[model samples]
Target: MASAEIGVIGLGVMGANLALNIADHGFDVAVYNRTEERTREFAAGAGELSSKIIPTGSLEEFVAAIRPPRPVIIMIKAGDPVDQQIAALKPLLENNDIIIDAGNANFRDTMRRFEELKDTGLTFIGMGVSGGEEGARFGPSIMVGGTEASWNRVSDVINAISAKFNDEPCAAWLGENGAGHFVKTIHNGIEYADMQMIAEIYGIMRDGMDMKAPEMAGVFDAWNSGPLDSFLVEITSKVLATGDDKTGKPLVDVILDAAGQKGTGRWSAIESQQMAVPASAIEAAVGARSLSAMTGLRAEAEELLGRPDLGRFEVGGNAAALLEQALLAGKVAAYAQGFAVMAAASKEFGWNLPMPIIAKIWRAGCIIRSRFLDEISEAFTKTPDVANLVMTPEFSRIVKETDTALRTVVAEAVRKGLPVPALSSAVAYFDQLRRARGTANLIQAQRDFFGAHGFERIDGKGENHGPWNMGN
Candidate 1:
């Protein structure tokens, strides 16, 4: 009957929840899954909201149920499946119909898809949705990338379903083509670094200080009320506090140490390298995940080199306070590197990405939502043209204040043989960043000596060759 205002394809966990969210917002949503049984089940489970949901048996029915110039959200497994779905839907959709890919797609794929849909009267939006299963059902942060007109068409519904901070929606139109996905990738990369740093601190507490799970959970809970307040921190405390019913032990202690990654963090590191920007913290986090996955190799290495017996990890004073400050410093470095990479990408791609808006939208709905992001938003709003986030006055002050604590923590971790890759990388990054004159001059001279690659002289002599005495 074409009565449904919108259509959602692929009723997986995310898709089903998003559809329910849309229906809850007073929009008649038509939904379809590959299996007809799943679609029928979803409709049946809708209960009181069943009337607002139009369950379709086939693609034809799904397309027919939505009104003209429909906005269809395809939330399925990313990559080839998305292309296949889009190909199938193209034949059924009319001109001006919108196709939104709401998945964790690589920005490159998003750009290619946008290009493929050009001049066909169909609009393509690469939307980055964050906040997990519950967030999907209640509210999520939406990052939209497409033409302004296309964003305008779906803004109302998207805004209505997004998390809010101080009565403002967390959803926003970031830019054209792949901007949303690119930003999302960086978001994940920063997430990797944040999680890795937290894990490193937990490792220090467990192995270095011999702390128990419940005690550490109390510390994390206390930190949540302070500067470190965020979703991940809250969850860490909850996870630590939880007890395994079967084993009668803290659930986290019984869990495996290995971690899994899904490529976004690696992409962030690769793209930063491509742009010649240093995102070492993100890189270190990605590397840590890779290393974690190599459980057999790690066991072999640990066997070959016995675990360090160096006793109690000692900081100068107040271990908890020092760890908190160190974590904050590392977070600053990770976020600084992430934002710097995005700034470079924005220029390279001509996205004209609004940094302040990006930060603002991230404050409520996304996985990385925090009071810290609000500070970043305000900082960017004040100094929109800053070369880097750390260069801003507010961030500069934070860096200065936390510098000593970061140094002490990294040094103590290194001394005690605790692995703190992301945290240590932050120390190195800050050291290199603050250094006015670095040792690269020697490398330049060596290059000139071996390959005749000229070096720029400090005494106004541009591109001068170094005199190398080679006794042949």
Candidate 2:
């Protein structure tokens, strides 16, 4: 008898929580892990949900437990490990069995895997599951990419286990092959930009204003009740409020400044560059992380260059309000860049991504979820082909009103000799986009003089060249 509705491989935190979520939603799930001890431990602690969970000792047992046209969800390390799992399952799966890869996989690899499994008559889906362990055990924002036929086979279960926005499932079939992962990569890239902007404002408040952590936490708590309301903002408040248990110091202060990344953010920036989209804010965020990793070099450089005296500066009254506005502006810039990248990718890949749907799905159960996204969804819904989010009436008004505050924050950081790359880049990008004509004509003239790169004339139709006299 076919027992489990689906089988989940790997008993890692995400996999375990997801299996439980499936079972909790009234679907029997068979789970397997490479180590039997871990599998046994999970089974032992499953409690009441244990009745709906089938703990299999081997891959064969796990495969056998599911019905024909079996749906297998793989949650493991991406790249080679994903390929290894697929190879292991190929022989076990019959025609039309579904294999969903739920990891932060590069889209190219997903496309290759999709092709590899096409001949075997098995369906391959590259899905992006956002939100962490808690969201997985409750509901996650699911982005799935596969054939419509394959999606039909498991859509019910997928939808049932995904977060909802206005009673609609947060999951959707973004496109075929790698579209889901591609969008997810962009999601993470935007997350990096957003976090960097917040950190920049925090630096201004802490170093320039000398504000205490609890005071900053109070400001963030207040922002949570306004347009900045989001998971990240809410958590920022908590993180600021929390103190180190050992020394009673602010936890963030005690923690190391170094940050780590898993490559998706870099990939998104690279893709945007390749597509010729100006995601300068995202690039700046990634560059800031890279620079942060050079702690030894930075310390040595600081010693050699001497530190700028910031003691005279005091970010006084209205600093919190100024920071709030700057954050909102930076967020608008970062999201505009992300959406632009996606728009270009959709056209390049023939994905026809639904921007409004993407915004709607991201409203909850994702790292960057915000009330701002609700406004973004409405903008797209009102005009699907809006050139940029900043140009949208709702966002434009906010940006217009907040521009002064953003400029004020950046100027203060500059005078204090603090690095505010993400926020500064956002302002630069906004200025560049808003300008009708730029100084780039001189660049074209320079290129034409040296390399005969050919420059287009504004007054005429054809490419024109200038005759340069070499001083002899």
lDDT of 1 at 253: 84
TM-score of each: 0.98, 0.97
Clash totals for all candidate models = 0, 0
Candidate 1 lDDT over residue span 82-158, tens digit each: 99999999999899999999999999999999999988889899999989898889998888999899999899999
Candidate 2 residue lDDT tens string, 1-472: 7689999998899999999999999999999999999999999999999999999998999999998789999999999999999999999899999999998899989989998898889999999999889878988898888888888898988999998878888888989889899999999999999999988888877877788899999999999999899999999999999999999899989987877899999998999999999999999999999998999999999999987876634456777788899999999999999999999999998888889989988988888888888899999999899988888899999889999988888887888887899999988998999999999999999999889888998888887888764573
Worst 10 residues of 2 by lDDT: 309-318
Clashes of 2: 0
RMSD of each: 1.1, 1.3
lDDT of 2: 0.91
Over the full model, what C-alpha lDDT does candidate 1 score relative to the true structure?
A: 0.93
Candidate maximizing lDDT: 1
Candidate 1 Cα outliers beyond 4 Å, as residue runs: 469-471
Score residue 362 of candidate 1 by CA lDDT.
Answer: 88
